[model samples]
Target: MTSFITPCDSLADVRSAIDQIDAMLVDLLAERGRYVREAARFKRNQAEVAAPDRVKQVIDKALAHALESGAEPEVVEAVYRSMVAAFIQIESRQHQALQARQAPDAGTMSGCICA
Candidate 1:
């Protein structure tokens, strides 16, 4: 749950609060990154790494949570879409790496990831 903060009385205070929140966001993203790395192990190829249905499900859940938390849905949707896209790329790389390690002489997985 998000913690409540007091109203800012000055620009410096506002910036400080934003910085703190950003730091927290970075920390959260790092934790999420670790999980993404682990998720790569379960995926067999780029297609599974970039599962469009799973992406939609994640966005759907995020949008619902945005409504529940009084967040702007448009901003939430935009951020999630971009973040998910980037994570898909990262996960794709990890998936390729894992596949290579499992069969080093076989080479990278073939075919593009398609929905």
Candidate 2:
């Protein structure tokens, strides 16, 4: 990762930093995706994947952290909302797949057996 304090005089330098930061963000998102998949194993149903209370809690935390980090709360909220939405979709798919594997002939189960 590039140092945040590194000075940039030219457009290319700024672009380089942005590219590096974007790469890091991709890596972090991938890691987060893995955790979301793991969490799917613990989720009981589709409602759990779209847990509203948990979403609010996460957004609130992200807002506070954004303020502390000198970033716009609105921007942080938007980004988190998008990320959470995507993760919820992923989790839902993973949950369905796991459920299908657990009960192939039983249609669908209501709750997670692993829970």
Candidate 3:
């Protein structure tokens, strides 16, 4: 279960709470990465993978969410920026590999008779 701002009695309690949140974060990030990789399949090239405008939109949305959730905008922006950058790189590489893998197959059926 997700926890909110709960008062801790000692450092151990605080550490435990943070550990739980970290675990949740790791799971969520992995799920997000899966979607990011899937997104590579839809992209045609590295430029589409990067999509700077989409990056700005995502960060803007994150900032808005931070403000609504009472989180520090700067901190949220910083984390999101780093996360988005890393995802972009991942997507770019995935896109290149996808293109390379498809390139060889795209011409393989050229000599086949189409009934």
Candidate 4:
């Protein structure tokens, strides 16, 4: 039902390969967010909301990995910076919803600063 193909052997082939890879990355990202949502239920306090420092640390590590892997540092940084920002927003929202459900009377539980 499926077959394996090697990397692009020409410019057009390379473009096509890149497109396919991008699609796979999109799917993986969706799966990653699903897990993020599950983790959302555990963030009881608002302090655990956004955590810019943690995001920065993650971005730094991602950039380092990108460089070490011979990927374009600027491109990697840009992509991850945006990606992390978006995820943080999603995480914060999900955390808030969870906390509200778990503690309806409590006003904003405490944790890390949101981004």
Candidate 5:
């Protein structure tokens, strides 16, 4: 669970808080993207993305953290799944790009990029 500081007494304070939140979100998402790339490499190599053991580990850890932070487990799970789905979509796009780059036929290259 991410905790944010918000001083909503003034418009300036609200704007400042929002700016800070945007920065934090960017930083966190960038970090998560790095992990997504690493995971994509594994996925490209034909390794499983939805391993039950790994998913269980994540859910258990998230649940524990959410409990400690007074956050709802279901809310955390929903947010996490949404973020993960976005990452996976990015990963799939990257994999497609790599495949297009490696294609032996030049016609496929233009088709992929144009599409």
Candidate 6:
């Protein structure tokens, strides 16, 4: 549950509200990053990290969500594109690390490479 400010007038009050919203966005992004890491575990190779079809689907969904929420679709699409690209890179690194850990010589290393 979240509490939203109504009719903010002062600069300080507006900044406070923005700060709260930014905190929530950070929490959401962290949750999304966790899911991205989990997704990396399921992927067989790095190619699956930059999945074009899923990217298109996500962008389309973001556009629809922005339109439905009275936000600018273009802005939402741009944000999603940038966010997805970053996540793809993270996933790619995670995939490579997992692959390396799975290699035969990985037995010499410690516990949980994904950690």
lDDT of each: 0.89, 0.90, 0.90, 0.81, 0.73, 0.89
Stretches of candidate 3 exceeding 4 Å from the true structure: 1-3, 105-115
Compute the lDDT for candidate 2.
0.90
TM-score of 3: 0.86
Those runs of model 4 whose alpha carbons end farther than 4 Å from true positions after fitting are: 1-11, 105-115
Clashing pairs in 6: none
Better of 3 and 4 by TM-score: 3
lDDT measured at residue 72 in model 5 versus the true structure, 0 to 100 = 90
> Which tens-of-lDDT digit does each residue in 1-115 have in candidate 5?
5676654899999898889888998999999898866675555432355444665677778878999998898998887777766776777666667666666885545546562
Error of 3 at 66 (Å): 0.3
TM-score per candidate, in order?
0.86, 0.86, 0.86, 0.75, 0.62, 0.85
lDDT of 3 by residue, 7-112 (tens): 9999999999999999999999999999999999998778889899999999999998887888899999999999999998888888889888877676468778
Superposition TM-score, candidate 4 onto the true structure? 0.75
**Model 3 whole-model lDDT (C-alpha atoms):** 0.90
> Model 4: per-residue lDDT, tens digit, 1-115?
2346686679999889889899999999999899877877777665675777877898899888887777789999999888888887888889988766677455555774888
Q: What does candidate 2's lDDT look like per residue over 1-115, in tens digits?
A: 2225588999999999999899999999999999999999998889988899999999999998887887888889999999999999999999999998887566557465864
lDDT per residue as tens, model 6, 1-115: 2334588889999899889889999999999999999899999987788899999999999898888777789899889999999999998999899998888785456565874
Off by over 4 Å in 6: 1-5, 106-115
Q: Model 1 — which ten-residue stretch has the worst lDDT? A: 103-112
List model 1 lDDT by residue over 1-115, tens digit each: 5657879999999999999999999999888888998999998778889899999999999999999888899999999999899888888889888887787464545664867
